[model samples]
Target: MLNLVDSRSVIKIIPYELIMDTVNEHSCHRPKPTVVTISDLLATTNNDDLRFALLYDPPSVVLHQCGGSGCCQSKSETCTHSEHEELFLEIAYLSDPDYVKKTYLLAWNHTACKCAAKNNNRVL
Candidate 1:
């Protein structure tokens, strides 16, 4: 069970079903599942929804974990589209067998890359 705290102690029992009603436990990695829906992926990155993901945290905090690429390996630096996608795909690949069958990994990867590239192409 998760608990929201006033000062580092678990004060209130936050239900395990979700970090909140809007966010599902599976999406938040409660059991650390993979193969999230596109909407789930978007929520994790957006500045607003991400803040409430944890039981305790402020909107100003943005979290990034290490990605294997050595170009600019610091987790502190904001992640690029490729890096984020790679991490997402990796988890889904390892943890969700259905993900490969449903999305057809290679095709999905290609499509996602194209979409990301198109988004990057936006200049205004």
Candidate 2:
């Protein structure tokens, strides 16, 4: 323990209360989370916007093999969407934002989808 004594020289001091009171409400806001669940996607529907988004900003081919829903998919297999659908899925990303696309890319089979592949392409 140290005892306080009057200093010979007067120095400027900032009040602790003043410093603490200056807290901004936004700064105190809850931090954003890093991980998320497909339940967020469950709120959406039969992939209209998802398709539009993919049509707008195509993602890298690196994530092409991703199982979209991140579900029971094999090493190089994807779930049912039709090649056009899959391409749209690969391109469409179930019609959501890139973050949604990323979520879709890494998500599991959120829904019970049929398993198949179609070698078809479409004009987007």
Candidate 3:
């Protein structure tokens, strides 16, 4: 049972399955599986959708650094591309069954440098 407080006057008790079903319905828009890690939840294609999702369900945010690569050079001191790539890599790593079970967050940070390099190429 999950108690959801929509507003001061509106409170509803919902079953876990119903909540998961709603999530699944929303996730069905994407071709990928419904079960997603924190990283995947953060990497939504639509910024508004991502913001809404995060607003409702806050994820465990992780800070990632740009690894001294000129790929993400821009006027801004902070590199948005590098952060996107890191989140993508974290999601990719979490998708792997071998590492997912051990600890998704742990595997995200511990994966080899090659994985990050491979994922970096895919990100814009």
Q: What TM-score do all the candidates reach, one by one?
A: 0.15, 0.18, 0.19
- The segments of candidate 1 whose C-alpha lies over 4 angstroms from its true place after superposition are 1-10, 24-124
Give lDDT tens digits, candidate 1, residues 9-96: 6676657554554333212111111232433443534344322233221112222322211222232432122323222232222223
Model 3: per-residue lDDT, tens digit, 54-107?
A: 222223444332332222223332222222322332222223323332122221
The residue ranges of model 3 lying beyond 4 angstroms of the native Cα positions read 1-43, 46-50, 54-59, 63-110, 114-120
Candidates ranked by TM-score: 3, 2, 1
What overall lDDT, based on C-alpha atoms, would model 1 receive against the true structure? Answer: 0.28
lDDT of candidate 3?
Answer: 0.34
Clashes of each: 0, 12, 0
Candidate 2: count the clashes.
12
| Global local distance difference test of model 2 | 0.33
Candidates by lDDT, descending order: 3, 2, 1
